[model samples]
Target: MIKTLDSVSNHEHRQIIEKTGYKVETLRIWKTGILKHSISNPSNEQLETFAMNVDAVLEKSNLHIDSKNEIRANCTSHFLNERRRTSKQGKETKENIKVVNNIKKKIRDNNLTVVKADKGSCMVILDRNLYINKVEEFMNENGFVKLDNNPTSRLINKVKNFRVSKEFEDKFGKYKNLIPSNPKIPKLYGLPKLHMDNIPIRPIVSLINTPVYKISKFLSDKLKDLTEFKPTYSIKNSGQLAESLKNLQIRRVLN
Candidate 1:
């Protein structure tokens, strides 16, 4: 059998060698075509060890092969593109953090309270009484005329009377009946409601009625120095800011 195997060409011997199980000695014998004097069938223990080694080699090879296949399927440029995308995201996150920190610092420097609301919007609240006092001081300094008291009730009465008057009837025409006889006026709890030169001045705590795009644009303008920062305000943030400001007022009232 050894002589016949030796007589065969190398290609024939290789073909025979490929068909055998993963026994190292068997392959060597078939490949070399040399029969060692002590040649014998592998022991069961030897076979098991050889099989385990072969499986280990195959598993390692398969891992490398799968990686190569993935690279080929996605194109060779995939790794580079993935790295660049991750780097860009990291840089953007860092820039956003820096901008937010800067805004917080600015607020602190101005001795104002800034609270982050939902959807990336923030609220700036000032002491209402202090702010009103400042406005009064400024008006007094400028020799501006001021009303004796708040005109909230007076304005409500005026609006109510106008709704039932001939002017409202002439303007609204058929819609006159649709107007409520006793319309409820929105109550201003902690807001400053003063009159200057007979013009009613009311402080707004909520910007909920303002457009999100406008708010974003406003924030962008305010924080323009932070070139990498882009503002994006949602309507939800506006409502949250209003609610927070109201809570602040309620806290003050309770205190």
Candidate 2:
């Protein structure tokens, strides 16, 4: 895989790829699945740890709840952080440029897709009819209803307010709909690299209403993983940036 990615192009071939369906910022190499851990059933030790953590948090806050109170939310946050940490420390999974070129070659050779090279990037005009059929079947099986208006038509604007009003209450917290939040489990956001890049650089997941809400929630959850360090504890000399900012404000008020 490494050799294949290496052989594609150093720089010149990037333009070739842009002409294909994958334009700049849309192309990404595939990475390992990010949400695999949370979906699987937890082990005994994992369950015990989760229970203990929830108990500790609740005890401090004077909150009490039964075991069925959906602690999965908290556990999912912790597990995703673990995965992100592992990914940052792990090796790069992206095949070099050559791998992409090779994929293009294979698609064209088999007549599976038509590839075109443009100055900016390569374009691969996939069979839209085939994809539409597949999507129709998937939507039918998934219990989704079609909208009365065409998604791209001016008629969409007529009912656009309905979408805005409803999607917020349904997806995010009250009055906090527009924020870009991280997902708890990474989904196939229907962008380029069908299965690649857990986080696309500039994701189009926002274009689709359901995925926009999901991705935003995940982003919000991911932000909580920032570490809080303390200074003058005698063990660690450094404080976290957030803590330092707070300390500076205190000193200014005191002075």
Candidate 3:
């Protein structure tokens, strides 16, 4: 019985059962383990009937046996792997949705301008005046004197000069600010090490000409009529941007 089954393939088994008078649902149930028996466990008479039916079907279809076997094997492996990948992605997507929802809630509650949230990080847009005001308020509440003569102007200047600094020392480094020992007064000041250009208060017009930006803009334009979609701030490349747009469409359709 094992040798007889060893000669047959899954597609052949399906075709044989399909050719018989039994419904395709029965064959499907058997394949899904709902049925206690499989096509391989058929009686001798059933096997004979299956064989005759498969032969007739194959003859009518004029399918090459070798080609059929090769194609079936390749497709089976390809589809099975695809199924597994899709299942794994579905689980990851569910987790990501939860995270994104939480982030959105926080943003709403805090009135923060968070543009997007994905796997590792989120993108936020800050208003310069609002941030400066908050800093000034904190400084006033803490009784910290501004380093320069003009508090608001000096605070803005410091923020403008703030640079991305890396540290290499545990105690003291170039980026570390020095405080006077036994100081007569507490002072609020910007770091001396930060000497970079001010953060852009407006959009960089030059970026519109870049390939990545163009691609993202094109996709957004194309999908404008279908749904409202925009690229997330964290998207670095055209492919990632496109995927975000695609997800937007899927979400709209699902909703």
| Candidate maximizing TM-score | 3
| TM-score for each predicted model, relative to the true structure | 0.23, 0.21, 0.27
Summarize candidate 1's per-residue lDDT along 1-255 as a digit string, tens digits.
Answer: 121112223222133211112244333433443222331333557646755665566566746776656645454355446556766766655555555555446445655432221211212133334445644655567576757986656754553355345774585354324334443433322222221232122333343322233334445665675586544654447777787567563334553
The best-first sequence of candidates by lDDT reads: 1, 2, 3
> Residue 139 of candidate 2: its Cα lDDT?
54
Off by over 4 Å in 2: 1-99, 108-132, 150-255
Write the residue-wise lDDT of candidate 2 on 108-204 in tens digits: 6544433332222433234444334544555567687857864443433332333445675676554434432422222322222321222111122
Worst 10 residues of 3 by lDDT: 191-200
Which residue segments of model 3 deviate by more than 4 Å? 1-63, 115-200, 203-255
Query: Candidate 3, residues 159-197: lDDT per residue as tens digits?
Result: 345554455334234321322122222233221111122
